[model samples]
Target: MNFDRKYLVWALGYLVAGMCVGLYMAASKNHAQRVAHAHILLVGFAVSFIYGIIHRLWLDRPGKVLATTQFVLHQAAAIVMCVGLLLLYGGVLSEPVLAPVLGAASLGVLLAALLMIWLVRQSGRAEAAA
Candidate 1:
């Protein structure tokens, strides 16, 4: 429904996903997915949860187009990064081909961060004006 709830849900989902990865690593005794697991937990779960808190406590209009775009962009980029790392580490994909894809995904994450910066600035300006 609301943007804060959406972010919270996303965060929880990522937490489950990340924990699953961790569990698999423990079971298989193959820790090659460490990078992916870490990213999923930190970038996916922690960032999204913090975003929920920020939107709920600070943002007046968290459902704006830019905010929605930023949320989607960050999720997509994190998914891409996690999947790419999995494939790369599992030897399912070669580095030469996946490197550019991972680079683009990383760039998407940066863009999402930039979008969040803009959203925070806009929210601050709105709050000040009010």
Candidate 2:
């Protein structure tokens, strides 16, 4: 499948997951998972959807290894971050126990952003060269 379509499909999954969390919070009146829920929507759904658009509209090399890596990294990191936040806020785990996981996930998110910037720059150059 094309990266754009794959990303868009996964984005809908994230949207559902995020919405489930939101509905749970609303019903329970427990906003403890608010941070996790927000991250799931923003990073998992919104960012992935935007990335899909970028790949579809801007990139000619959507199948490039770096693009695959960026997508995988972003999804994995976002999931980890969301899970860690949920564990922390739900009092299932201590901050110290999940600190490393959160930190690495945060760095992974930033790295995905950097990869996206590079990909966009490369796409611009490719257009110019063509």
Among these predictions, the greatest TM-score belongs to: 2
Candidate 2: where are CA atoms >4 Å away?
A: none
Q: How much lDDT does each candidate structure score?
A: 0.89, 0.91
Q: Per-residue lDDT of 1-130 in model 2, one digit per residue for the tens?
A: 8888988998999999999999999999999999999999998999989988998999878447898899899989988998899899889999999999999999999999899989999889888988
Per-residue alpha-carbon lDDT of candidate 1 for residues 1-130, written as tens digits (9 for 90 to 100) = 7778988999999999999999999999999989889988988899889888888888878547899899889989988998898899888999998999999999998898888888889999888888
RMSD of 1: 1.1
Candidate 2 pairs with clashing backbones:
none
Which is the leading candidate under lDDT? 2
Q: TM-score per candidate, in order?
A: 0.95, 0.96
**lDDT score, candidate 2, position 116:** 91
